[model samples]
Target: MKRREIVEKKKAISEIIKAASAPEKDHLCLFSQFRHYQYKGHSFYLKSGRGDKLSSILKHHIQNILKINMEKVYGSEWPSEEKSKRKEMVSPEARYIFIYETANSDPNQMSESVGGRGSQTVCANDTETIVGFVHFRFTLEEEVPVLYVYELQLEPHVQGKGLGNFLMQLIELIACENRMSAVVLTVQKENLLAMNFYLSKLRYTISSISPSRVNQLTGPEKSYEILCKVFGVEAKAVLEVIFSIANSAY
Candidate 1:
């Protein structure tokens, strides 16, 4: 072929390659700025780093995003007995506990529900400033363990913005990537809004429902529903949505 024709053909191939790769390039650029971690109803960003550093940042964001008051949640004076009890529950590899205190409740009183031996009080972004928090517990039901969300809280200010859904989706993704069956959690029947959100909106199915177990929270045990969503169904849908959002951002 003539030299001029050869040059023209090469230029045409280069253009084709660029056109073929443009969409993927765009996708990467879109999601480049933010690192996302899904919780029940919120997508947490951790500025990307080593696992320990990312965990700390995630803990802080979770607490601040929910706007929880730590002092009020734990109370002015630390209950020594409760602290001692929690220390006992902490094992070598227990997941950390995150809390976003909405009401002024004693940490000692919360011990039964929130604190235990396997929990870590993760660092928050700041002191005396609160939004909400989530507590996580790790368990090995099978060969590959799963991280369970024991408690999730969001202050009044942060509620109603669909953060709960975002957090759940994030957690589901984490569970799926780890090859866990699903993220499991129990919610009180009395909390109708939460129940409705989980059942109706999130599409979580009730694996089991217990009627007010003896050591349950003060209210009429009502019913405690253990909800779960398999990785194939809900988790896949969530990842699609995240990609969609990232694409749309640009």
Candidate 2:
């Protein structure tokens, strides 16, 4: 499809998301751009992962970004082996959001690069530079169908700038659309930034099923917490106390 059509589609998606977002979450939509982001000197478009090449690159990034935390929690070289075993992660089955920088334009042809939002068929396999990704799956988390964010990693340059918030809002929107119960993910306890980002920044609460809440003291600690944001009243009611309800609100 033409670039114009893709832009219009993304705008429609963005507006749908904006309308679905609650009043408290309106802050995440402060920026006009949703899939496209303006960085140091690049207009990065958010794309989808496809094919072996994009899958390989996605694994490279997952290992590259999380290697440090993996070593700290799971031992050195853990990510190297894990990444290969999990290549299916970037497959079409899972929802993968990729951010890429627009390559230098043909000066003779097009002078200034146009606004870069993700087109309907924006494939990382054919993109210029893959900067980051947010991969998620719709799955049963503690028996409730939830949008489980498997991985979110950005290049050092793209870490800030409200891109993460925008993507998370997208996650919630996806959950609402698919009738998912909530948004959920696991974060390494050692990764303070991730823990804080989900807990403090995004307002996700420690899941009742999280290892930390399950076995407070001597539980075989995998050093991670499952965090979540629930949608339905019944799900939240059940999840709100799944950890503390039976345990006296520990």
Best candidate according to TM-score: 2
lDDT of each: 0.43, 0.61
**TM-scores, each model vs. reference:** 0.44, 0.67
Q: Which stretches of candidate 2 lie over 4 Å from their true place?
A: 1-33, 39-41, 50-74, 77-92, 103-128, 241-250
lDDT by residue (51-104, candidate 2, tens digit) is 233555456665566553345655654667566536656454455666665653
Q: What is the C-alpha RMSD of each candidate to the true structure, in Å?
A: 18.4, 11.1
Candidate 1: global Cα-lDDT?
Answer: 0.43
lDDT of 1 by residue, 1-250 (tens): 6999978855664554344223212111222222233344443331111113234445456534433433233343336533542442233322332323323232232222123322222224423333544444444332223456666676675577666776676556555544554566776554667777877788765542222322246523444555555555533333212211111111
Predicted structure 1: clash tally: 29
Q: Looking at candidate 1, what is the lDDT of residue 164?
A: 71
TM-score of 1: 0.44
